[model samples]
Target: MSHPMHDVLGRWKAAFDGHRPGAMAELFTEDALFQGFGPAVVAGQDAVRAYYEAVPDDRRAEVTVLHTYTVGERVAGGFADVTFSDPTGWEAKVHMSLVLRRDDNGWRILQYHVSRVAAGG
Candidate 1:
């Protein structure tokens, strides 16, 4: 059987591939916490939208789930390997973790963190 979270991640990937920051932010909760490759940890949907909007138009991401598990009926956690590429032929790989919660609106991200992985590691 297929995992339900697969569908959720698919929507998230589609948003990024389509370069729609608003659509991407809609996948998170209102008070979601987001920590990208930078030192800053952002919270809230508006901030998340702003963060994603700053991504260069030429950049895109490909995600591969490394692990996933359910914490409970309302919570789930997962990690993914994300490869980001740009028009300049530059590519960077990062490890991403997400905590999702099920609400009336369905599964939404509550926490997200990402760290860059060494190219040759």
Candidate 2:
């Protein structure tokens, strides 16, 4: 059976597919922290938008939810498997932690952390 986490994940993916920064921003809180590809920390909607925009065209990820759990309106925790081809034509796999909140509207991500996994190194 599908979970609430799936709904939130779908919303996040939709934001990415549409490439709508404003829509993506709406999916986060005012003080959300998004740690993307690099080590830099992106906070708030504007910063998140800028960070996402900086992603190379070829650096698109397809995320698959491996697990998820929800705790009240304050938090939702999950791990996802992320696979993508980099701009340099190399495939990469990443493990992502998704943290979101549920308000009157719906779930909004409070934090998103993606960590790259070394391949057969």
Candidate 3:
């Protein structure tokens, strides 16, 4: 079966690519958790909004999925490279796992954990 999670991920990519920070927040649930900014675990829709807003206006995120495999309900794992447009040109290849739940609004990410890939990983 095709995982609907792919669509959510695509929307997320499009949101960031177009510099629509607000759209990015829609991908998460009301109390979703994000680990995008270092060790800080940002929680809640409003907090996520604030986090996205803090990013430079011209900056954007690009995600290239390396792999994806679904587990039990609301769980999946994938590898991807995320690059941000910044002065230092920061880039990260991370192994990510997402926990999603199907609600009245369809699939939404509830928790996301990402770890930086090792050198040559």
| Model 1 lDDT per residue over 1-121, tens place | 5554676788988888788999999999999999987899999999989988998877888989988899778988788999999989999899998899899998999999999998687
lDDT of 2 by residue, 16-55 (tens): 7656667777887888899978898879989887866765
- Model 3 has a clash total of 0
Give the lDDT ranking, best first: 1, 2, 3
Best by TM-score: 1
lDDT of 3 by residue, 1-121 (tens): 6565577778877876666768878888998988875799988878777777777766666676767767766565455666656557765556666777777887887887778777776
Indicate the worst ten consecutive residues by lDDT in candidate 1.
Answer: 1-10
Number of the candidate with higher TM-score, 2 or 3: 2
| Stretches of candidate 2 exceeding 4 Å from the true structure | 57-59, 86-90
Model 2, global lDDT = 0.79
TM-score of each: 0.94, 0.83, 0.75
Q: Weakest 10 consecutive residues, lDDT, candidate 2?
A: 52-61
RMSD of each: 1.2, 2.3, 2.9
In angstroms, how far off is 25's CA in candidate 1?
0.7
